[model samples]
Target: MRRMLIVDDEPLIADGLYTFFAKADIEDMEILKVYSAKQALEWLDTVKVDIVLSDICMPGMDGMQLIQEIVDRWPRCKVILLTGHNEFEYAHQAIRNPCVADYLLKTEGMEKIRETVEQTLKQIARENDFRYQAEWFQEKMPKALPQLQRQLLLDLLKRRGAKAWMNLQEEFDAIRLPFRAELAVLPMLLRIEEWGSYESQSDQRLLCYAAANIAEELLGDKAAVKVAELDSRSLVCYIQPHAGQLQQHGLEQGWERTIRFVMGTLESIQQSCRDCLRLSVSIIAANQAVQWGGLQQSVNRLGLAVFDSPGHGMEKLMRLDITGETAGLSLRQDKLAAAELLLEHMKQRLLEGSDDWMCSFRQWVEITGEGGPDDPFLRLRLLHGIADVSLRTVQEAGLSEEAGREHDLAPMLHFNIHTRWSDIIAFYRETCQWIVLRRRDSCRLDESHILMNIHHYIKQHLDGDLSLTRIAQEVSLNPSYLSRWYKKVTGRGISDYILERRVEKSKELLLGTTLRMQDISGQLGFSDQHYFFRFFKKAVGCTPQEYRDQRKGAAETKM
Candidate 1:
């Protein structure tokens, strides 16, 4: 069955079209009715509709924008537009875009609408057949080498199984990567830094490709290297440590020697990259060698290092442990700069509400409480570092504007240190949570203010147009955006509230007025007495004269 969604802002018009299509003889068609383009887009997000017949003049997201979204999201779904004569020019511009099968002037009547729908359905049916046939042959195509290489690496990294390894070895031999099997390798992470400083590089992917080629050439003499760009700023270079360089007793005999050689090659890699690419590169050398089974751990550990120690980014060679700890807490001038740099990184992560920051927070608390330097002054310094990060996080998150909270770290500064580790950790958690609560309360207050302004404007402008466009301008918002926000705040469209108010006002005028029906209609901004009468009858179950007569009869009887 083909599904059709009809969207229009007029409740009667939208419902009328839904009822008309439900009764149409267009095969086994399923029909849905939504009052605005915003609602139609929400429906599209959850369900795929075969055809969309949308009015181009609704308040939220007009038909042209609606069709554009439909074409972008469900390119196969056909759209037929229904627009008023005044909007036909706007609709014509949209007609030039794809996925719009046709548009009809609403005055063209229901017969034309039925005909257009039938034609669009025939096209959709033929397109589906073509798609099915095309996909059947396309599935039989061969896979490419780049895809095979990535899959092989993933399987090895995951340590899939013994048979998987055998398959990988066969694939490796076929690709002629004999250097890969030559034993122990180190996972040294390379992060491209100051990339924004490069004026000539416009394409980041091409630059990364060039960097990988450069690394291969620089390390060619000392090591067999495989480099992969990990993300926008990071890369992974698996260096196969030359066998002759490792001492005979599994590297125990020359651990320092291995470190020296690796550092020299890293300096060469960094300097060569600067000379050739005009880009700075930072390398984080792991403390030990790792095989395929441990690759994931290496990635996570290194990823945390880059995040937790953003200051160490310039240090050329950083030896990172899994604890996310720096060697000293500003124990010297260099260490103090490192500490400040690390806190700057933490402050940013806290603003982003990163769960990784939370994990690092917990680990830092535990590590410092148990294994930090025994000196009292050092432990106090560590406490101050943690406090600095939290205080800055609250400031950046804008706590001062909400709940009128003071943006000061005096409480954290005056907090008394205790011997118990739990006491210290508890204090940190309590302060962070308090700021978060204050910020949320302030946001709710702001939303309430916006709602009050909307209500005030509607009541003040009953004689005016009172249309969404005018009211949205009063509040400095896009009409469609205001529509969604009003609905979200009040649980119904603004039009629904306006209609209710109009009905209530008509009841009062009918009871209290002695004026002619046309005069009363003019006061309500209705187009004419006839439109006013029809609207009253639909809402009040009686014509305006009838409603007045009934009210007079009730008053006499009560007297």
Candidate 2:
């Protein structure tokens, strides 16, 4: 069943729809009834709602404002606007935004809302299917090389599984070549400029897949491409190892031509919404020899700029100029300039590199933490960014020449230095861990934080008396509120997480010590061993004795 939120200024209208949804066997649906947009936004901050049925005319914040916020922050939530007026002008403007899934007149009755919600949910499920299918294709589809080659690419980008990557490198010695390489990641930003007033979700999904297909074509053995929706207005085609040549002049010419070709192809595929289409390509380059933070950061930086640009077809390559002397205030200005320049500067620093370029790039990465917005993530991304840039820089440079000279520049590029990068990265990660812990300590909310301190308390006191009232009192929340919020946030009731934890504890005692099953059951606060057995079987798919037997048999087999 889909989770839905009904936002209407009128209590009767909200209650009517809520009651209708409940009786329709969609009652299993987690429904949030909000009398105004204010309550909706407040609840939305914590709940993972799937659909919204909101009236257009509410005090303070209207349906339009709610829709805008949903689009901005919760892009995945489908919104069906319930408006009284039938002005085509209003419909035209409201539907212009991609996040407004459907608009219905309040006079259409409760049944219409039910049908609209069902259709919206069905479409969402189908889009999720498409997403999974695309991922499956990414997993199974072969490139010009074998599975080993693809894994080698992943290993190089991630700076992991050195032995396997090395074995592959040795095995594919004919294709192996290294050059002065840096990693560049390109994420396709699909900005819908003017989605027609009656645009369907299927059309949007088609446009996204069409963009992905075009990206795969242009990228052509250069990068691994995948599609995702970054927000309401855009979809992303994440391309890894974003590296090309600055050697031959054709590299620039070819890249520009490729951009045109991709734009044209996307236009052709999404011909229906040609006027609505906009594409922004963002690239981040790092050293190819080490790991950066993660691919997600690069994708985020690239995808975030989609709405900031205009025009239907355009390409912007990130470039950096580091040959300058500055001090104090001048230094701060240059740093700000670099941050503002972002992808452009990094792109230039990658393909056009000197010793000065490397030092400047490294310094930028050290300061910004691989273009990460936060500290821990920043450091992780920096390591990843460095490896990506170095690997792709080496790979592209080598690809320009013959593949035979792979190992020639590997030593000079300090390839050995990256092998030890994991250690330094581990140290950096520890610092990030501290940072994350510190941030969590300061920034987390007390009222609706999903971390479940109450659950922790329950687990600690499970052996003693435990009841809903006692538990609610301990958490300083009403029993009813605790039950609902716990289920909503954790996808299970308090009793459920607690029961599972107790069973887990009991299993440890059963296998690791000589405790009897009855004693273990009692120790876990189960009234009877029989009841515990039933609960264990229901949750674990095995009785306590059967679990112990299976473990013992596995141990024997291992011996």
Candidate 3:
């Protein structure tokens, strides 16, 4: 009886397979079912299984990881993938991998699965036979070893191979054996990256098996490759080639073609993995006869080339400058830093009331709005910048009081400009903007229009000493939390904004009419002219009188 492990997240799919397998009359198979890749791996640690059937996608640590683990721990285990998404890459990749036994699309129904299973089992049996025959032939080949001694040696290698291989010459001399050549070893490295798709874990496992199959085919009879996964996103294959076979083949173009085929097959599988899963493939090409050090250098070069080359979807082979082994993580970090700087720059402009604020505001709006829900906060912070622009606009205009009419401020909002912040902010910023407008309307009409009510509470009594804490109380929120929330939504602190508006009103009173500085200060709720002068200097970097003088000089210069 053969042992099989079935991995899939969906109960219906798993149960369906259980029923189908039972009906197939393959009674000699004992099946274990697991819902996740992690569970499958845990089971693999202790349970010896002949075959594994896995789904492509699951909640966490998906099928690709499971397949890699199987190939690493049990190279002989046959993997059959049953996936729902139809993509030729899965089957093509599976055909390329030695570890994968078969690929069966779920849509093919139970009959096809049964057929694939039988074929896989048959193949496994044939390989086992080949291994035995190869061992036996090695023993009888007189040039290699005499038949009688060769048979004994073969048994010793299989039974206590680790110890025997470590001290082969010593053991041979002790046993009166005559083979005198030094031992040689060849190493192959295989690395796989995950598809950008969201295929079921079972399906992904099957795809991973397909990748392994490609590597297996490339090595053929000349090498033995062990499959393992580095993480959720990558797979590793270790290849040990037979020196004699490699000498006969030399460095062949067929091996290069095999690498291309593996990459192409992976591309095809990614297409089936769902549109989201993008893939990039990289392969290392080296002379099979090279020593372990040269091989390691070659593999490292290949790795750098694979990761460094820029290509979308599946890429075949990347040639590396074997002289250098540098990676590019530092470059990627610099790009991330640049993105943050750009975001912060936009926020600063929005808060400062620049006349070209609309352009910066809109850019921020578009970036965050497009960020989508998966990473909403990261992009949404951009929206907060837009809201900050709008709120600061109102505060700067000294219009936090309910507009006597909406049209009065409509032009300032610049809603029609293609790159206006208002349009970019759209629904997200509008939600908070409505809060400010509602406050203003509530005080103006003594009636609650949701848009103007909040502003009304603040304006009705300026002497009430309004702060985010007091303001948020009317809106039902904790002070600190509301302040942070407002800043996140508006890109400016509530306190800074209120001060800007108050200072602007004081400036308007001082310049537009003959009101004395003390009278203007008193009317705008400043304690005195001195206090107002210091406040104005801090905000504008000049005293009130100096600002007026500059404005007068600027007007005369313009005239």
Candidate 4:
């Protein structure tokens, strides 16, 4: 249902309009009335008003100002300015605001006003329909085929245990994977070590796709290779022996030959990336092949190995020797794999501004602490990843200088100084906590600065043009956005603030000086003495002379 509010300072006119709307044959509309813009706003605080009919000149916060308040509160609400004054400037200004449907003089009959309101309702309905149609179109559109395939591979790699692979073949066939579920596969993890000048996410993704294409081109003849980019920097390729080669050379010989060819082709892939793309990457291949059920474990181990290795400045081509690492896969290795995955998850959360990343970090620390002794390489990797994200956040938020002064930020950059695992964890937590707090402080400071600028401008221009549009221009913000932001931050409408300031200034002038009423009204930016008198009486509950005389009588009594 739609709601309409009629605002006019005069009681007869406000009631008359309400009675006319209530008796009219308008459908689905709840009509209300208020005596002033301030009362209208107070009603608007709780009720969702769909249309407002207001006088362009009121005692406090006139119709022009009310338009901004309505825009801030109920953006879709239409306003019709009603005034006795037939000024072209007033109509032009009202027409400029998108929410203002019409500027009808009170001389225009009730029929014209009601017709304008009905038209506004239709406009609102059309806008709502367009929004719904746009949303429907978005929902019905299909995602890209490559994105679906990548997501499937990522899900498969993260799945655990044998039960998870029950429907693996059907899922693979859905995305047209070349290999069957029964065949053993080799998983190779690739990490892009350096992108040189390609820093943006889109550029890096293009490089990753190009690099994968180069790998497929080099090793496509020997094995069935399918690559899925796991993140911006890492990709995993699943390789299986081609059916023709396996049938011709036997399973064991063909599989062994395919593995050798893959290993040999890594050098060529690396060279191609360097020569053509000018990018450096690190590659880690599993020492032995695994079935679909064991693929997750092999990929996890390789992920940890690739991430833990020191590949900061150079490309690394290494084989993950899972067989040689302790007799069987140990608990420590599993914990390390879990930790690596958690860190990656935390990185994403940190970028998205979620506090859950801190919880993930704490869980990683607890897992690391419970895993008996710590690996130096694991500690170094954690430190590097955490410090990188922390510093990047600080820099992006423009808090680097403050962070440097508040804590020992230098140690975060140099991981060699932290000798103990506990020291590393403690320092990282401290840095993260500081970053979170400082970011909040910086946001508060920014908000305070904006409010200060707005308040300053309002105070400075009290006698000049204090219209919402002029105030918005002074603050360098859209009038609607400025009104919304101010109300949200200060918990009061900007119009209310302006009214309060004007009242306070009037009181000061009445008590402190003997300025003539007309001069005082002009100085306060009122249209005339009569408007100022009504404004002061409405706010102070007394005329200007009465207020001054009451204060003088009280002062004389005190003396």
Ranking of all predicted structures according to lDDT, beginning with the best and ending with the worst: 4, 1, 2, 3
Question: Tens digits of per-residue lDDT for model 3 on 337-423?
Answer: 333444445445433433343454355444434432233443344334444545564564455664444424444344332344444
**Could you estimate the TM-score for every candidate?**
0.49, 0.29, 0.26, 0.50
lDDT of 2 by residue, 95-159 (tens): 89776789899888878878898888878888779675787756565453333443443334233
Clashing pairs in 1: none
Worst 10 contiguous positions by lDDT, candidate 1: 327-336
TM-score computed on alpha carbons, candidate 2: 0.29
**Better candidate number, 2 or 3, judged by lDDT:** 2
Give one digit per residue, the lDDT tens place, for model 1 in 1-559.
Answer: 4668889988667756765775583555667777789888877885678899989887858888888789777888988888777565786686687788898888898889989999999888887785666775455433454445545554444442345444544676654443455355567788887675554545666677778778767765555566766777677777665556554535554444555567677887788778877777877777666655456556556655665665754635576653334423223323233344455655555555453455555656554655454666656777678777776677677764542444444556565445465666776666655655565565677778877887788766666556555576677886667777888878997867877878887888888878888888777766357768877998889999999999899989999
Candidate 2: regions farther than 4 A off: 131-559
Off by over 4 Å in 3: 23-27, 88-92, 130-132, 139-559
**Overall local distance difference test of candidate 1:** 0.68
What is residue 442's positional error in candidate 3, in angstroms?
95
